[model samples]
Target: MNTFHLGLIINPLAGLGGTAALKGSDGVAQEALALGAEPRAAERTRIALECLRPVAERVTFLTFPGPMGADLLAQLGFAHQVLGSLENGATCADDTRQAMRLLQEIGCALILFAGGDGTARDICAAAREGQPVLGIPAGVKIHSGVYAISPRAAGELTRRLVEGGLVRLASGEVRDLDEAALRQGKVSARWYGELTVPEEGGFMQHVKQAGMESEELVLVDLADWLRDSWEEGVRYVFGPGSTLHGLAANLSLHTTLLGVDVIENGQVIAHDVTERELFNLVDGYPARLLVTAIGGQGHIIGRGNQQISPRVLRAIGLEHLRVVASKRKLGTLEGRPLLVDSGDPLLDDTFPDAVRVWAGYREELLYPVGWGS
Candidate 1:
């Protein structure tokens, strides 16, 4: 039996800044960990790998030492060969680049990595031209178009390649955000390069449409509608996005542009909160979640706002949730359903098939919703 070689690299420190409310984890992994932020890369990689279990005997994984890859592969009892080594402590971009070089040298059929856009940038910088790679969405700033819609989708896509199924390869743009400017309420995305990726639109995500859309008037109308329709005692858990930022401005509340914020009675009760903080704030209170879909991506959950976690979403009943997006942004989807990948399959399944999107004043469109995987 000819075995397919799969390369795996896990950026253990990726996404630490998300739940810690630090915006992006580019230079603040330690700070995020200090704030009690737990790393989600390994667990997300595990989920992706779980889909490959049935064909395990047909696939051989080439991976780096310890937390980068081997550790989780061992935990899952997957047959994998460990390569290279790390000196100590926290891993850096150089380590990811090094792993990329090693994987490329070994001629693995496909390189699977888990992390955010920064990690993608490192991989892109070190990659040999036309080297096939795929990303598992495990990072905070996932503006890149190279990643799968979700971890399971990544696994499923890889499985197709291993099983000799028909899969088209295409160039995917690697994009990253400027963390400094992002923290200052600015959304700046730059195209780093491109990677050879599996061309499956349903399984892969489009690059995030950075900054606000051109329809400023629509945003104003939506904000005014929300301001007027605000319930008296309900706490609104606002997820990150320029649409919500505009809404916050109308209420004169300074909300985080890339972090979750909670407001009550037209005032911000909590500014830039973590997952735990958000859960605690609305665990037993009248709460509603207000989120906007990523332009061109149609992701209302699980992209940048990991803080509106499964528990938080469950606590704020699905019926109480709200979505806001411009008609132009909705048109970017080209008829695809809005996506939700809260990391819990059961919770994801409970979401309504279609959600009521507030596109303008007194205008509501029932948009279809789909699981990210």
Candidate 2:
């Protein structure tokens, strides 16, 4: 039988800083750990690899030893070949670049990595131009366009490739931010490079559009109206993004620029909440989720705001979910539908065919929502 060699790389410390409220995990793995952040890259990788289990007999993973990749593959009982040995310490960018070099040497059909934009940079630096690589979003910094909508989306796209389905390849941008600047409320994002990634409308996210929108007045109007219309006793979950941030600012509530927050009756109930914290806090409360689509990508769920997890969505009830985006931001999508890849196929299916996007004051558009396979 012909074997499909898939290269796997996992930065075990990729998202350690997210829940710790440290912003990005690029340089502060130790600090994040000290702050009670648990390693979750391997778990995210497991979620992606689970989709390939049906094709295990045909797919063989080429990966690095230990936590980087091999451990998860072994746990899933997938056939894999460990490329190189890791040292007696935590893996770094060098390890990731080295793994990419090894994978390129073996000519992997497609390379699947679990991490944020930093990991994408490492892969871009080492990968040959046009080489296919896909990212499973597992980081605090995911402005890069390289990652799939969610972990399951990455696995589903990979499974399609292994199953000989028609898959087109596209270049995905590798972008990262200055974590220090990000911590100080300054947005400093830079484009390092690009990687060849598989393209599926709802599967791959577009590079996060930065800077202020032309519709600043519209945003101000929407924020003013939403704040005025805030329902009492209802917990409002404000998701991450500049649009939502602007709305929260209008309410005069201090919130995280890139983290999830919960507000109730104009008071900050929870700030910089993690997935678990969100689940616990909203479980029994009458809550509403407010999220905006990525400017160019049109992903309303499952890009950087994994904190608004599938379980959280269920607890909040889909009907209570609200999407807010400016008309200009929605225009960037160029007629593409807003996407929902909540990592749970069942829950994703339950989303309304079209969602009501609050564009401006009393201006709502019924936008179609796409659930990519």
Candidate 3:
């Protein structure tokens, strides 16, 4: 029987423990709940495994115990080998790290981890000695090519690796983003290294480096307009991306690239808001939603940010919404109307109608927020 040796690690609190402005979930007992940072590590683990269902029989899931890693696999019926015995509940980064080290000591061929930048760093530090590595991208700022384009893509790459398919080993850039700067909506970069990443899986994008490129300038200008145009007592719910951060820069506030932020009356009310946080913030205070179109992928909402639930969007109302983007950015989407993925099937009907986007100083284009499939 052909078999492939694979290791797994899930940083249970890795991405879920961020310091969103609403209440820095990081290290805060109460605030973490307030921000609604769902314990996504488990869900991510399940998603990755489900994606690899086709080749499950040929793979061994050498992983941590319980909440640390194995629970997700167990939930999805993965009866592979579990490593690192634990006396108490293993539900943290320390536990995951220990399991990863143990996997290395046993000479596992590849380390597949579910996390954002923090998880990526640990994998680089522990497995850099030519051990193959890949990421599930369960973090907010996953500025790393080591990750597959999505959880499903990550599984596809793993299947190829196990099958000994033409999975060429290429150097995927590992980029870490400053959390502090992330809140301020600016991306600072440092090259981590080229880890052995399998190609042919569209699970990555070249980390968007901070620069004053033409596209960036266009975003900066649009942000300036919103900052200057915003009125007091009005709420501003920010979506993820450099374009959204451009608006934050003008206000001298911070933004998270892959998370949601809420602002009001020239003051930041919240950062890294989840679906629940978004609703509470909107209902408690009237606000406007400012978002940008996803680059290359025609997504206005839902694709990457499944957190923006439809209930929240309905409460905020599209009448008070605004879209910002560069004309070129929209053009790259090539007429594929923006998509919405709010987890609610009804959102497909109530999504904004031909919202006007300020692509340039005077060049305005009406884009359909969602198109019928």
Candidate 4:
């Protein structure tokens, strides 16, 4: 039997800007740090490794030194080889590139990296043709098709690849947005490059689509259902998205397009609220969270709407959480589960095996939800 050699690389600053609402972590590490943004890439990588525990004995891990990769594996008790060195503080793109080159030189069968689209681009630049790479998503904007839908999904795919299962190698797009433009509420995306990814249906994400015309009717139907099902004196916390915005429109209420809002009795109680403000509002009333998944990405939480923090989710509880998405958006996932990364691992596991999503008026779909690392 041949031993499976997997290379690991982690960009420590991958998702530091998410909850801070800075949009992207590319060049705003210092700003995000000043705003008290914590490093999440390593923790997210640990989630993937936890899922890989079943197959750990059959694999050897090659990783970079310190916070980049080796430290997490060591803590997990996985026997791994540290391939390169880095300074004590702050690992840069060059470190990722160097680690990739070294891993390639040592003939790693696959490389499992933790970061966002920017990290994906760095790996793509260093990877040779036919080299299979997988991404554990831990970024603010993950529009790329090269990542698993969630960290557990990443581990599942990694296990399948190492176990000699029927896995297909496919070319995946690496896309990134201009961080500056994103902070300004303007979406400016560009194709960085392509990477060879290990693909298994329902495990990896598809590239996000621009817009869908058919979703309008579905949104109106869902909005109608919400209007009919309205409970008296119950407060509704609306998450940021076009879907929820349309729902607000149906109620003839105003909403922030990309900011969290509070609605009561079909009226806007608060608009463009922050995390603290959301907590304050939900505490005194019967509240429920209303959110939609990122089309094609399949994330219901912890992507763009970080305003609904884990603290808020816990206060609202899982039963009070409601998800709405069009059938078209669900179809883009190809049966992948809806994802949530509230930045709290314990809170993430509190969710049930599946949750019900309102696809249209009187139409419900039971979809599985996973914690995206």
TM for candidate 3 is 0.49
TM-score of model 2 vs. true structure: 0.54
lDDT of 2 by residue, 249-283 (tens): 77688889899999988899899999999999899
Q: How many backbone clashes are present in model 4?
A: 0
**Cα deviation of 143 in candidate 2 (Å)?**
0.7
Pairs in clash, predicted candidate 1? none
Task: Name model 3 segments beyond 4 Å from true.
Answer: 17-30, 85-93, 184-186, 201-373
TM-score of every model?
Answer: 0.54, 0.54, 0.49, 0.54
Per-residue lDDT of candidate 4, residues 1-373 (tens digit): 2245688999999999998888889888889999999999999999998977877886779898889888899999987988767777669999988888888777665789999988998998888865668999999889999999998889888876554333455678999998888778888999988887766743222223434536778878888888898888988999989989988887788899899998888788899998899988887678989999998887888998998998889788777787887666767776566788889988877664345566777765445566797
Span of ten consecutive residues with least summed lDDT in model 1: 201-210
What candidate 4 gets wrong by more than 4 Å, as runs, is 201-373
What value does the lDDT take at residue 78 in candidate 3?
A: 70
What value does the lDDT take at residue 10 in candidate 3? 80
Candidate 4 residue-wise lDDT at 298: 79
* Overall lDDT per candidate, in order of appearance: 0.83, 0.82, 0.67, 0.81
Ranking by lDDT: 1, 2, 4, 3
